[model samples]
Target: MVLVPLLRGCVQLLTLPIHVLAFLGVWDPLCKTTFPYFMSRFARLYNQKLHKEKQQLFSNLADFAGASEPLSLLEIGAGSGANFQFYPPGCRITCTDPNPNFEQYLLKSEAESKHLHFEDFLVASGENLHQVADSSVDVVVATLVLCSVSNVQAVLKEVLRVLRPGGAFYFLEHVAGDRSSWIYFWQQIYDPTWKYIGDGCSLVKETWKDLEHAKFSKLNLQHINAPFNWTPTRPHIIGYAVK
Candidate 1:
């Protein structure tokens, strides 16, 4: 018992430097730099697995824009521009992300997506999109973003503010499972560590509740298990809400 306590103390002492660096914000930039690389690989696998669902979800976007007119799309948390391929043709996309490191990846993805036009890349967070104008975008998109936002309600409000009168907001997010399910229990257990490792992503956010209360003029949302190996992210909600 004494040996175990001594080893625990020694481990804490060994990790003191790392804690100090984290406190001084040295680790943040490093994490930001490395995260995009891993995320890009994961995005490829995730897109492949959820191709059908994404196709169905994105098919509805054609209704928002005419054949001749290009749609003005604002994507919040547009990491690596992973959804660019699914967007309607001739879309003018404005990408915003909290991580500036993703800009390079976004540019690469934009080059590969010939059907879409890249407008601007803003370094911003979903909770506060001060750079974007009010009612300026025809569509606002958020995928796998609400889980990491500090305030989901604030992000939703920002999404609504940027969208035009008859605009739409599309979201695909992993949410907490039912209260009585084992998945929910695992989510609760993994949430604390997941936040740090997953870069502030919460494993247990009931994002559907926030969307329902967001006051969208017409809300159409549904839940399904995403075709991914990660159990925490399996319980997903995907759909669009009209403003």
Candidate 2:
């Protein structure tokens, strides 16, 4: 008797398993390739308006010592240089990122925000930025960085140390959800797994509390809930503080 052969197949569970796979570096290539493309697209859409609203903050990022010198700005975790477009014209920038995967993206964004001048790109982490001198920069920007860092206090102190007496530290971050809400509980529960998969982002960080204690000369902060962003990380803060 002859037997017929049957086709074989297995079902793949896409959602739940991706978390573990991403934890294993399986998603590194996709993250590196896709991040810049999405960042550029989003920057172009919101940068102009964001700059317009935050123009005063950007304008304050200047030195009057001599008109010949452009304002110097240092950004920690400058992923893809996405915030460059929001800076004032001719402001000189030095970008640093822990992930060198974004080197090419930074170069691309360097051209898009042509008004600002890029001085260099350093491979560095936010927790330690010793290469930048104390009170040396007119401004320091950190967007969407603190939650993933090893030490938020250390990073904030570094920002304060690098900024000139009157210089400003501008930041935009998605902090933890309200403590009273169930979202906060979920955030806490998912933190370990999320951090492992989402590049060390602590979705439950009460980052504003830290900023308040950081002792900025003057801090002006506002909390916002951004629509369409992931719920656990939707509690946002955008502000500037003088060092």
Candidate 3:
């Protein structure tokens, strides 16, 4: 038994670099292609249950923010552009992501949300959203993006800086839990491997603190204790607030 565990540790150690490269897209023979496709495919199914809940949350946010019509929306980490269909009336949504696979979904969203016709799509990353003007957006959405950003602090700062006064910052992300010993263990074991597989996804960060430190005006938070499929330790936290 000791030898078996030791051998497994050794295997993981040896494959660490390979896993990192694959997760970071450095070792892709297809040049960083197909990985996003695979990830989007995975998200399409995994996120289906959460979508309805998210729409409700967004509706709540719309009411809380009093966004009637022609609201400006900037969404970072626009994975698969699934949220496009949820944009409220007269909303000008600017969905952004570095992944080209999301463009088709964005177009589909544009077609679906006809009332949200004033929409734009950008191929970009959260680290540098230079295309968007500072302090110009009325609403900022960072749903599930903090878990994967290269610099969570920078992204939060950007979100804070861009959002106008009374504008809301909506997010629904998986966060580290207080009582997940099994999740903690799996996180320790597969944390390094997932970094390579999920484009720098981290199961360790306490994102709640990051949001708190952003210094928003009206703070609202809700922690969901749902177990994840990949691991039981990491619980998904879904909620939002204003700035």
lDDT of each: 0.86, 0.74, 0.70
Which candidate's lDDT is highest?
Answer: 1
The candidate, 2 or 3, that scores higher on TM-score is 3
lDDT of 2 by residue, 1-243 (tens): 021111101112224565656768776666656665665566565555455445554555554212346788898988877677567788888999888877887888898887988888888898889889888888889888898898999999999898878778888887888887766766666665566455678988888888999969888898877553445766778888887
Q: Which residue pairs show backbone clashes in model 2?
A: none
Output candidate 2 Cα RMSD: 8.9
Poorest 10 consecutive residues of model 3 by lDDT?
60-69
State TM-scores per candidate: 0.89, 0.79, 0.82
Ranking of predictions according to TM-score:
1, 3, 2
Indicate the residue-level lDDT of 150 in model 2: 86
Runs of candidate 1 with Cα error greater than 4 angstroms are: 1-26, 66-68
The TM-score between candidate 1 and the true structure equals: 0.89
lDDT agreement of model 3 with the native: 0.70
- Report the number of the highest-TM-score candidate: 1
Model 2 spans > 4 angstroms off: 1-68
Number of clashes recorded per candidate = 0, 0, 3
* Inter-residue clash pairs, candidate 1: none
